[model samples]
Target: MAKISLRPLDDRVVVQPQEAEEMTAGGIVLPDAAREKPLRGTIVAVGPGKMLDSGNRGELTVAVGDTVIYGRYGGSDIEVDGKEMKILRESDILAKVL
Candidate 1:
């Protein structure tokens, strides 16, 4: 298995998307293309906070090692240290995994 580390800056977050399950309903084993991209991810790193219009930094809601669910069209994909990772602005994350 491959692993990665990231340090985001200025209201950004480093996330690794969680892979979807291999099986489907009615006992069907689905292939990679038959599944939808998971919108969830693990929070690898978080930025300081959002910069306010007055230059004040807001509080951050997400933390490192937290599992999260993000938006479909959000985040920028990149390969870091030979592994895939996503660099997302904090606002792009939709919710945290329970």
Candidate 2:
């Protein structure tokens, strides 16, 4: 696949979600119907911080290449180069994966 060149705008982020585990540690293979949406992903792109009413932009806590966890229903699903991705607001991010 080609490198994604998308740039988010205004506190938004482009995330590439991790694929769901197909098997458990106990060797149980899960079917597609049993899989859930992944809440974790790596940040592929970041937008500038949110614009403040005072004309200053708020700082963004997350940076590019950071792995993040978000709300289950938070982001908008999108596809780029036939690969699934999510676009979410910075506020939607729950935690950074160190």
**Per-model CA lDDT versus the true structure:** 0.83, 0.92
RMSD of 2: 1.5
Off by over 4 Å in 1: 1-5
Query: Evaluated with TM-score, which candidate comes out highest?
Result: 2
Per-prediction backbone clash count: 0, 0
Residue pairs with backbone atoms closer than 3 Å in model 2 (clashes): none
Residue 10 accuracy (lDDT) in model 2: 94
lDDT score at residue 65, model 2, on the 0-100 scale: 88
lDDT of 2 by residue, 1-98 (tens): 24587989899999999999899889999999998889999998889889999999998999888999999999899999889999999999999997
In terms of lDDT, the best-performing candidate is 2
